[model samples]
Target: MKKTEKIITNKIKINDRFWGRYLEVVRNHVIPYQWDALNDCLPDASPSHAIENFRIAAGESSDDYYGMVFQDSDLAKWLEAVSYSLENEPNPELEKIADEVIALFGRAQGEDGYLNTYYMVKEPNNRWTNIRDNHELYCAGHLIEAAVAYYQATGKKQFLDIMCKYADYIDSVFGPEEDKLKGYPGHQEIELALVKLYDVTGKEKYLDLSKYFIDERGKQPHYFDIEKKKRNDTKPFWFNDDYAYHQAHKSVREQKEAVGHAVRATYMYTAMTDLAVKTKDESLKKACEELWNNVTQKQMYITGGIGSMEFGEAFSFNYDLPNDLSYTETCASIALVFWANRMLQLDANNKYADVMELALYNGTISGMDLDGKKFFYVNPLEVQPEACEKRKDKKHVKSVRQKWFGCACCPPNLARLIASIGHYIYSQKEKEVFVHLYMGNETTVQIANNNVKLTQQTNYPWDGNVSMIVTPEREESFTVAFRIPGWAKGTVMKLNGEIIDHIPLIKNGYVYINRKWQENDHIELSFPMVVERIQSNPQVRHNVGKVALQRGPVVYCLEQVDNGENLHGLILPRNAELKANYNPDLLEGVVSITGDAERIDQTNWNDSLYRPVEDKTTSVQMKAIPYYAWCNRESGEMIVWVNEKR
Candidate 1:
């Protein structure tokens, strides 16, 4: 049978082993930090509502409805994370933390089904009417996802019931029913949440409701217009009334450029793709493709950052790629990963995977410090210290990450994405289940009526050699898919120590090895992560003479902490001596770098328009590290891109 045919009948599983490690990381690294910040912010600071969401999913919720704080998508994602954590495997410490949090949520939730502490305590009278601005639906959407994830992980019904009520409340408030308000979310999260609900509950209504919002968006009686009219405020959301992109004067499909709130745009696109795939809607599919093209081909940064200008922290026109001032929010990149993955499921394509890979290695990971406390909401490639310090607009776009912002979403989101990363690894088309990511972990997915375990052992990104021990329940010949990355210069794949018919994997996209498999089958894949100097697209005018550090999917950067002086001015000479070694005592385990730290005579500051330039070039050993590793030790200078001054 064709490999695709077999997967049509089989269910793939992401094993308990991989998720166990993820839960520990989240419990140890993420939760404690967030909790500490919360304790400092809210005395009643507990991840309670959020905990209940996870607890209900873990089949541990004592109550049907989780409390107020847990009612939203933030809580929903947290729940989803917990559900994933304890799904086939259980972690005691993680569960204990979840219990503490759930009890808090139970206390915070009201009896009337009203939730959300922010509004419950802060603005009780301001519900439903402010649908466009408030995150009620967004929060509900997250709850729905958490419910589904919890149910899937532990077969729990309480959280699902709670979120179902929340979803129903949302559906009742904003849809075309009698006494319903004609509006949609200002932030487009509910649509994706509904998809999750439908998948978990098999409720067609949820799917229909999700499509309704997506279809209703950008039509007359637009959500924002109505919201403005209701509030008697003509001013635009985010204070950008003059900007056409913010209002989206053109149809979403016609709106090629990414415009308005970076997170909102990505969430909307994610919903669009979800609706498109669920219904196979042609127009929606076309719109999705068009928008994808617009973002990838035009607005995206070499590091895969989307938003350029800080005014909106959103999309601008083509070739407006500026290095000095960028508002490429980390969540946008995470959302990009979500949208791209959804697109991949709809149609087997390389572009989606390519973007997904790019965003994962650079933009998404760039959100947090290597130790995990510090975070960067906006990731900009180029920064001049004067521009950073003197420019108020640019000042908001931080050159270094900070510990927990009040508008914090990216950090937890990053943790969750990294933890649940196995979902992105293997995708099935018929009998052929494709392995797009090469991380060391054991995964089990049902393929062709039997459980197929992929014992993938590899030190990837740093090293390209991957070996997968394919263990199937029964003797079967099918297809095993491997993503050939768009960045791979050369890749080789082998099965059972015998080279398959060589499909020269250009860019290392998916290389499918279709054949019969037996017990103890071995597959070896290798892609040399050659340290290479990369030149950006010529249209990206700022990076014309500059070179980016790259090995595998990661784009490395040099910080002034390790190597000081005129970092932005320093140019890495072509064929400059390159050597890489691991510093175990460094931030978050092993870090690799090339090019010795070179120093130059300090520029003398004179009270003249132009002072006599120093003619001395002082040579010292220089080194580079991952961008995420900066700002941990001291407030030293950081450079994502360095020039090789000849």
Candidate 2:
């Protein structure tokens, strides 16, 4: 497969009608609140103690490691988000704090260049002893990502050199060489991060290290098992004997199913795709293709959520999607986005972007609240307040977003992803520019031997009209491929107020418009936005007789706040006339759907669980808000798929 180059986030400035406000909130509100959380200034939030851990490790304070083994990642991820934000909106104060933090990081490094606070402060001798359960390498992955972002955003090499030292140290410790330890991370993040590190520095060693980790994972005589027996620690840890939990059931090349923790598996798959495209490894590419099909075909929800059960935050089986008991961790969906986007880079396929957009608009954004303060770690398709309260298994499914979590991975992950969304919109390969996502943004692309600035305007996920104005330094010939989203039916593309009726160059999921561009050359796209009814595969037992409402990329849900109680007693008629209406005062001004439906009256039914008797039904109107907007109002029953009236 041929790979396309991407226009990095730094070159893109967002003025999106839909995502612009969200990005602003992330920069202004979320970043500050999270910084406060890291410093333990937020009352009632989980104590991060992240900054204190760094202080101790840097010898600035007399204390020990105060949080989880991976507590350092919170600050690392925050710095990454700050780096992206700094590229667009420069803040001198934030840059000063970041420089101070980088200096502390330099001081915190040991002589050998290892930089984990937990082991450095607490288990100095036990470094790399329990890589299976501990997150030393996982934390290093986030730090490396932070370093790359910081270097790119600010052109500062202080933190980059620190991470490089750490990576060099890791390269020396673990590899295929006889002198190195045959070990990989229990969590799968560093694999992808190493690829990013390699890309930035053009370091062959880092690329070889990432491939070594990917190739060595889940091989015979399993290194994780060998490492576990070597430790001989009686203390219980979150280690599963089933190697599938970490996606090590077999070597990655031999693995076909998406198993284990959804986030870990997706991260590993993402790295594998990266290596596959970079190295042109057909075997690895085939495995990725099969796994991708397995995930989207059977395991995924209509909201693009994965990880069915919370047991291991893992997949159960094919066609085993459950609604209320789902453990669709927000991070997992974000990882899905990561994996899907990489797949698109390998080959410009609309199928990949379809899932990416689905998750971004619904499953992924649903992780955070509209105010950008509270966040949901687990996003379930259906929510029952009583179930979330009383049932132990359903505890992961929260009716409302929480301030913080003990693990606290999803919030920072969401923040970083949201802050760096510009990278996902456009990709460049030589003279070809692919517009994969639609949003209002102005970006400069280095293509056709010229820096071409393009401005996009759209109110996407609600409306389907898009306008693009192209400005070039001089008249240049280039091909601009606009992604026709799979959901966009009957789409029309126009150039300079004239309809494009000639033979259109359509491939994968994009329409290629090739021409010599001039300043202010305009183009327009029209994708009709209408209420859509979606259904699941028959094998999905929970949604066997149901239909879901959708408009463009946004999935709509019937919440108790809008539909009243006894939500299950209502049914959307098969021939119901659904209408799309935009209300400015509703849920941050979302386009809502209204339709005619039947409400069953159970007042005359006996008090038995099941009765073979007729029940009165009344014709009524039902309203549904976007799935991401659910639980924002008064907590009540909420469902994505509703029964179709007979």
Candidate 3:
């Protein structure tokens, strides 16, 4: 029997409350508030404005052409969201709205090939001439992803045909063949987008093109610079972006640390992982491993944030994790999830999932406000609102989420991530289906030419009693791999309501259960949610005197608004009794900590920098919320890691 045929996969069906949160945010907040704010920020006199941009530089224009990048990505994200919702609720209103949004996008794509507004509207005579900077390829990448997602969601081919034309057009433009001009996307997303195109159409060309881009990238005789010379590369693609980080000195894997444009680096790494998985290339896989180690071990924040410096908005140094002035972009964290999840597929490692979970819980989710209209570009851990203003060099580190942004990356980026998250749940090779994330959702996927229904039932990240029911097409023995989270201390697995004994729960950081599953076989996993105090590695000097809290996947932090007075003065006194409570009335829905943080008072009004008055202890109530939800409430002080009260 085929592997997928042997095991039945069941899933936990996600209702509106589960899957609709981010989508609802997109519909209610993103469209009306942020998108317009972004459009308003763009220069009206510029050639790239809404009316005259990439797609129709030589022909008649459509509103759909102008909204291609945002519209296509938004449609793709909405399609995913609505499909998940329809699986459970099947709302006509949402379906109608989603259909309309996709309909306009479907109409905008040209017949022979081409879908960009700037070209169609502004300079019809100069479409391909400005491929380097005009976002022609970037637009194609978004449309390709949109086509795949929309096709999967509704079995609609209207937009898919359009993207096929666009992809074929782009594929024709760049390749490994001589005289083909070995050009790659300077922004680095079309590679991953091409993978999505291949997945839907099963066309070897799309996959081949994606691989060519990955192989051609970072090679000597740099394609970007070569293309620059051809176009007279006047200002460079992103005129402001100096091509310092896109090219590589050695091999792609030899590149040790993250460099150059923050978004470009992350997007390239994401595509590399996609290519690695598709081709099963060990060298590419090895490169991904080295890069992951560099990010998590050294260039990562305690709150799972990345990009310590704002200069290029890229990673600067290892252990250079600054709190008050950190440009940990919300989009970068989203990209980290993208990279980490891809790494998870290339191998079965707890560490990959660990970083993914960290980014999702803290860095990624921190992008949006509770109401969803506002968004944070940078998620800094500690905020000295007073100290923040004096820093000239750290201007990119905005402590609060803004209504909209000029670059406008994080909002739509977060939307797409939350929408396509089902892909991160499980992975299957032949016989074994590996369960990765624990969410209350049900999913049906084909493996080994057999249908597997995976139904999960649990309120994860809050409580860890996860029960999975898997059903196979035919009874065949296969190894079912369940992830044992790195944080899981007392892990237990049960089969058919009976506890299984003598099976290893931890192996290379994964628990494997081999069994011949029937039509309905229930597997229960208990991941004990223990309150763990997280301290930085000894190498992190600044975090030595402080400790953060974590129960399950959430990293907790204390803000001055809730604690009152000095946030630095607060601490947990000498192994104080720890308590956790779910405060529904707090910021959205969050777990709040109210178990005594000792306060200190210093009355050295005359001191300048060091010398202070006697340290006097003052016991006070300190409440801690999820680090992601902290800054949305007030403009006061906030701290992620706090002084330990001894």
Candidate 4:
């Protein structure tokens, strides 16, 4: 079996108009602000006693443990973001802070390698007793990820060693062995993190442990049930023993549709793909493919958001996506990106990369405000401040981003993803390099026993023109594949100032260019950046007669600040001439979509709840901004889907 290839995070440097600013915000603003939030220094926001829990466990503070049981994962995610920031540019103060945190972790860890501040400080004897809801293993998984990332970024092994010890302890407690407890995480994360540990340490036990967790899930006489029975606790399960909520309903190989909590489902799928590639498990690979098709074809939003309902923060029936009541949690989309990238590794298909890019540009980044200090846990397609405030069903929807949350998972998750944006741009095999995303960056890839330097310059998402220069250490024949996005049409290519008149070799979704490279060969690609009106399938009842606006990879939304107070009453004409204009002075410089449309006038209703139907209409010019940039200015009603006057 071929070894799975990974992008070396430290080798790639991002410098793009779209992503560069996000990276800078993650480094300079989000990271420091989150650090303060973790330390409980932000008096204006909800208290996050994450760091204090650690201090209590380390015996540095005598305070009682406060916050959610999963609070420790917040710090873990922040640490992972810090590692990525340090990889982009070193800061001594940040490093010192991370180092001090690591020292505290060492002090907090028990002699048996048991870690997790919740159990350590609050319930010492109850460790591993409630794997169903305690989130102990889930927290451990995040800590392991932070450890691996920090070690990779700074060449520091102390954090890694601490996590390894903790992992070893976990490995001892749960496995197929008669003495070990047969349990898996209710929240599936440690399985994926263990794969990262195995990649770095080359320890087969880590890989085996990850496989054990995946294989043991959803088996007969489920582990959650067994654990519950052993405790003899009569409390009803929060999910009413709906094992699918945790994705533990059946074996992973037999599960076809995406079910359960959106984040947990995606995380488990990511680990399954990772293990399938590593161990050459054909069944696992097939299961992943079926699940992938189910998600992207039936369950996904146009913005690549998942998890339709807020009831369980989980997926609903197929094509049941509601524009206003959607609970597209930010972390779910980020995890979707993670799963998609791993799927790309398993197969260099453009479908995965396309969804990855969709989530990055629209759903995931929409969770964070432009300044990066504020964040949204739910990325709704349409929002009305009054509805959110007055309606019980719309209570979860927020028209504006908040400073912080008591749950607080999405903020740090967004931070780490934006900080590590370089990892998604390009991937490599022994002699093949696949460009998954069009981001301006420079990086070196080892191909065919030689170093190849590649630099890309593009104003993607705003303009579709891309220019690339390839420089290898010496003349060598290799293949470079550029992804032709699914949405892009009438693409043109030029190699070294000469047009390729003949049909180019296209595979999956990439144009393949294989040749013996010279010192400074140039490649240029142009994709027609035309505004498109997208209509949902008839099965999606909510969007049947409506259309959404999209240009390039960006999804556009109509805001009250630009359109009017009643955005829902606006109707887009069937033949409206939609134009894309780059407004540097608006919404932090976005290409806004403008068109002449009509709105139903409600001026003469005159205190009547019900009135005779009439076409009391007025002409208005509609403006749509990038979905990610909405609500960054004034707070008002926002709608992605506009009624079409067909």
The digit string of per-residue lDDT tens for model 4 on 1-646 reads 4667676466788889889989998998999999999999988899999989999999999999999999999999999999999998899999999999999999999999998999999899888888989899999999999999999999999999999999999999999999999889999999999999999999999999999999999999888878887889877677755889999999999999998799999999999999998999999999999999998888889998999999889998788899999999999999999999999989989899999999999999999999999999999999999999999999999999999999999999999999999988888877889999998999988887788899999998899999999999999999998998989988899999997742458889888899999888999999899999999989999998999999989999999999879888999999999999998888778999999999998888888888889887899999999999999989999999999998
TM-score of each: 0.86, 0.97, 0.87, 0.98
Of candidate 2, the 10-residue stretch with the lowest lDDT total is 1-10
Native-referenced Cα lDDT, model 3: 0.69
Candidate 1: stretches off by over 4 Å: 1-24, 39-74, 96-114, 177-179, 234-238, 242-250, 382-390, 504-508, 596-618
Number of clashes recorded per candidate = 42, 0, 37, 0
* Candidate achieving higher TM-score, 2 or 3: 2
Best-to-worst ranking by lDDT: 4, 2, 3, 1
Candidate 3 residue lDDT tens string, 1-646: 1111121222434532333465566555554443344244424321223323322333344444444333333334334444443433456676675566445544555665766655655455665664444566665676676567656656668768767878897777778777576766655677888987887788989989988876776677766667667756556445245454553434576677776656667777888888788777888888888888888898899677888777767776778787777888887898888888788778878888888888888888788886777788888888877676778765665666776554556766776666566666777767767777787677776656767677888867777889888887877577778888889887888889888762555565777787777778999989898778888887777788788888888899888788886688787875776778876677766678777667776554456666545667777777888888878777788888888855
Each candidate's lDDT (Cα)? 0.68, 0.89, 0.69, 0.93
Of candidates 2 and 1, the better by TM-score:
2
| Model 4 regions more than 4 Å off | 501-504
Candidate 2 lDDT tens digits, 1-646 = 3443654566789988678888898889999999999988989989899999989988999976788999999999999989988886789998998999899999999988999999988898999888987899999999999999999999999999999999999999999889989999999999999999988898989989999999988887988767777888655446455778888878898887888899999999999999998888989999999999999998999898999989999998999999999999999999999999999878889999999999999999899998889999999988888889999988888888899988889898999889888989988778888888999999887765688999999988778999999999999999998888888888888899998853357888788888999999998999889888898899999998898988998998999888888788888988899999889888888999998999987676568788876857899899999998887778789999898975
Q: Write the per-residue lDDT of candidate 1 for residues 44-114, one digit (tens) a residue.
A: 33333443343443445554433443234554455566656565357777666555554555555556555
**Best lDDT among the predictions, by candidate number:** 4
Q: Using lDDT as the measure, name the better of candidate 1 and candidate 4.
A: 4
Residue 417's C-alpha lDDT in candidate 3?
A: 69
Candidate 4 TM-score, C-alpha based = 0.98
